[model samples]
Target: MNKSTYKNQIKIITNKNQKEIRIDKFLKNYIQNISRNQIQKWTTSGKILVNKNIVKKNYKIKPLDFVEIEISIPSVLDHLEYKNITAEKINLDILYEDEDVLVVNKPAGMVVHPGFGNETGTLIHGIKYHLTNSNLNNFNLYRCGLVHRLDKDTSGLLVFAKNEYSQKHLFQQFYSRTIQRKYIALIWGNLIEEKGTITGFIGRDPKNRKKMTILKQENQEFNKGKFSVTHYKVLERFKYLTYVSCNIKTGKTHQIRAHFKHLGHPLFHDSIYGGNRIFMKKKCSNQNIEFLNTCLKILQRQALHAISLSFIHPRNGKCHFLCPIPEDFKTVLENCRNMFLQ
Candidate 1:
C-alpha cells in the first residue's frame, strides 16, 4: 500500500471482444511476466482496481473496462540487510553487455546466487565485481541485477538487468513465459517416441527436502506445488541412451530432472535423479564395461546444458541473444557418439 514502494503502474482498456474474461485472467494476458497466482494475490491485497474500485479474482471483465495494476518492488536494502552475502572478484564468461542489460554464459558447477552453503564466489558476486569495476554506474548493488537464475551444475546463458527498471521488465518476461529457453540433455534410454510433452506439478519431496519431486495433485494438499510442463524432441539415439532437446514451459525447481525421472529416463550422469548408474542390462565383456565406465568418468556431471535463450530487450525491445554450447558439453556428446552410438 506504500506509494513509495510501487515500482510500475499498468493501465489497460479492454476491447469489446474481451468481455466475459475473468479479471485475473485478463490481467495475466494483458501483462507480460506475471503469474495468475500473483494476480490473484494482488487482487486480494487490493493492488488491482477496476474503474477505481478494487475487484475480486473471479470478477468478469466487461467491455471497455478500465484496469489498473500497481506492482510493488522489493527494496534492495532489505535484501542486503537480511543476507550475509558479499561480492567477490571472479572470472566470468560475459556473452553480451549493454547499458541496460548483460548476458553471461554461466559455466557448469558455478552457483548462480549465494545461499547458505554457497555464500561467496557465485555468479552474483562475479556480476557485482564486474559492475563495480566497470564504468557502469547507478546500478542496484544487491544481487547485481539478476533477473533469473540457472541451477548449479547446469551451464548456460543468463541475463541480468543493469538497473531496477530493466530488472522489473526482464522479470515480467520470465513470469509470462515470453522468454524462450532450450536445453540439450543426454538421457539414459532410447525414447519410444521422437517427441513428447510432460505435464506434472513440481514440489519439494516431503521426505527429502534436498530433492524435488513430481507431485500427484489428487494426493497432495492445496497449493502444494506449481504446475509444470516440458516438451522434448529426440535429436539422436544411441544403443542405450538418447540425446534430446528440452524446452520447459514453466520454470520449476528441477522440473526437467523430476519429470524425466518420472518417465523412467533420467539424464545421463544425473546422480540426484538416478541417472548415474547404468539403466540397461546387457551381456558385455569386461573390456566393454571398462569402456562404459571410462565414458562415465569423462561425462562426470549431468549431461544437460542451457544451449539457447531468446528474449526481447527491455530497453530497446529489439535485441535478441543466443549462446553456443560449452566445450565440456560438446565433448560429452562427442564421446557418447564415438563410444556408444557407433
Candidate 2:
C-alpha cells in the first residue's frame, strides 16, 4: 500500500504486483468518498496526474506509475455539504413542476446551493423544504435533485430532477450539450456586429480563481478547461450600452460572462468582470454619468439573465421553459431606453 496524503493532495504509486486498470475506475475503488464523475472531471482539468503527466480518465495504470490528485475540499465533499444544509421554508418561484422534474425561476441574489458563506436560504434549501412538505420523501436528497446551477447574481431558469432516473437522464442531456439555453444581457459597450459568435476555451484565471477567463490557446492547464461558444445578437442598442440575446453552444462555467468580457464587453454592472465602472468619453455629460449611476444603483449586480431553456424530457418527451427578466433587470433596461432614445 504505497499511498500518502498531504495538504489537499493524494499520492499513490502502483506496486509491481498491481494490475492494469482504468484510472477513473481504479480511483473510484480506492477512494471511498469520491465519485467517478468527479475523478473524470479532475483528470480532464489537469488536477489528476499520472507520472506527473496529465492523462485521460481511461488511462490504465502501469506498475510503478505515480498518481497525484489535487483535491479541493468543497468539490470533493459536496455530498457532505448538501447533507449539512438544513431545509428552510424559503419560498420558491416555481415555473413548472411535475413528478420527475422541477423547473424554477431562480431569482438574482439567491445562491443556487449552500457553500462557504452561503449555507442557508439557498435555492436548494427551499427546494428541499418544498419536497418535504409536498410529501415526496423518496427522491434523492444528496444534491436535492439539482441537475444544474446558476451564478449567485445571475437570475434565471434552473431545472432539478425528482428521481435518480431523471437525474441521470438530464445529466446526460447537459453533458452532451443537447440542452438549449439562451441568455439576455445588457453589456458595457455597443457591439460592432449585430450578431457574432465568440469561441474560446474558458479556464479559471490563474491570478484570480474567483473568476473565469478566456484562454487564448491550449496550454497545459487551460487545455483542461472546456471549449465554449457563445452566439450573440443585438436586441437593442443604447447610447453606450448594448442589450444582446446570447445562445450558448457550450455550458462552461461563466461561459457567457467570460466570453463577452474577452471581447471587451463585459455584462453591465458585472463588478467581478469590471463592468460596474464607467466606460467614458472625454466630453461625457454630467447628466449621462448621473443617469448611468442611477441605473447601476437600480441593478446592483450583473445584468445577465438566463431567458430561456429547452430540453427533451426523460419522461415527457419535450420540455421548454422561458423566464421573464426580473424586475430590476427590466427597470434598468427601461431606464436605458428612455435616456438613450431621448
Candidate 3:
C-alpha cells in the first residue's frame, strides 16, 4: 500500500496470498470513516480505478491487482447527501464556537439529524445553512461535525466538531466515559434511598422493535444487550413523584429511561415506558388525581433534561457547559411543589 504525503490518493497492490474480493467491499474495509455506499458512488463517478481502468462497483480483484482511489477533501459533503438535506433559516442557540468546535443548546422536540419522517428542518440542516453562509464554512467539515446526539424530545448542550480531527477527539472522550454528563429528570414514585445506581444489560425489545428494554437474567448471558449503568440522586421529592439527577456511566439508547423503568420508577410523562398516566399510591382523592393530570398536561414529553456536560477539548483545555431546564419542565416542577408541598 502507498499513500501520498498529503493523503489525496491511495494506491493498493494485492499480494499473491490475497484472496479475490469485490473492489467496493475491499475499499470500505481499507478506508476509515467511509461507507461501502460511498465507495460505490465514487466508482460510478470514476473516482476509483482498477489497474488504471474505470471499473464497476461489483468488479472483483484477483491477486496482483492494482487499485487506486481518489480522496476528495472538498467533496466530503457528497458522502452525507448534502444536497438532499435542505438548509433552513432556523434559530440556533450557540453556546460556544471556535475554529475546532461548535457547542449549541439544542431545544426539545427538534430532531438532531434528518430521518424518515423528519426530512428537513433538522439541526444539521440549520447548521449547514448557518456555516455555509458564514466564514466558518470549510472543506474538511463532515456531517456538520456531529460526534454525539440527544433524543428528539430531550433538550441539552451538544458539542459539534468543526473538523474531522476534533470529531475523532470528542468521539474518543465519549467512548472512554471520560466526559462528565448529568441529566435532571422527574420520575414517578419516591425512592427508598437518596442516591443509587441502576445496572443492567439493555437491548431492543423483541416484541416492540421501536422500544428498548433491560434484558432479563436469562438473556443477559447470551450477550443480547449492552451493559448499562445509571447513577441517580434524589434532588426533590413530591407526594407521588421524585426529581432526580442522573449521571450515566454508559451511554446507550434510552439508557436512563430504561434503567429507571427497570427500577420501578419510570420517568414522568415517558409514555413509552409507562410513566405518562397517573400512578396511584394508596387511595388518592379525586382532587389529587386532577392535580396530577394538570402536571401531565404541562409536561407532555418525558421529564428529562441534560443539565451539565463537561469534556476535555481536543485543541484547548477542559471545557464545561450547563443548560437550565426548559420552561415546561420548570412549570411542572413548580406545580408539583405548589400542590404537594403546600
Best by TM-score: 1
Scored by lDDT, model 1 comes in at 0.76
The deviation in Å at residue 118 for candidate 2 is 1.1
lDDT of 1 by residue, 1-342 (tens): 111232667677777766586787666545534578998999999998999999888999998888888886553333332135565789998989977888999988999877889887898888777887888667545533676678898888888877656766776666557788898998987789999999765678877887788877575531356667899999998767788999988778888888899899998888898888876746555665676577678878888888888888876776666777777668777876887666
> Candidates' lDDT values, in order?
0.76, 0.80, 0.79
lDDT of 2 by residue, 1-342 (tens): 122222356677888987787888677645434577998999999999999899987899989999998765332123334566678998899999887889999999999978799878899889888887786556655533676778999999999877656765676565446789999999987799999999766778887988999865555555445557789999999978999999987777788889888999988899989999876644458988888888899999999999899999888898799988899999999988888877
* After superposition, candidate 2 runs with Cα above 4 Å error: 1-81, 136-144, 218-220, 281-283
lDDT of 2 at 156: 97
The order by descending TM-score is 1, 2, 3
**For model 1, what is the error of residue 146's alpha carbon versus the real structure, in angstroms, after optimal superposition?**
1.2
lDDT of 2: 0.80
Query: Model 3, range 194-215, lDDT digits (tens) per residue?
Result: 9999976677887787888888
**RMSD of candidates 1 onward, in order:** 5.3, 9.9, 10.8
Question: Backbone clashes in each candidate structure, one number apiece?
Answer: 2, 0, 0
Worst 10 residues of 3 by lDDT: 1-10
TM-score quality measure for candidate 2: 0.76
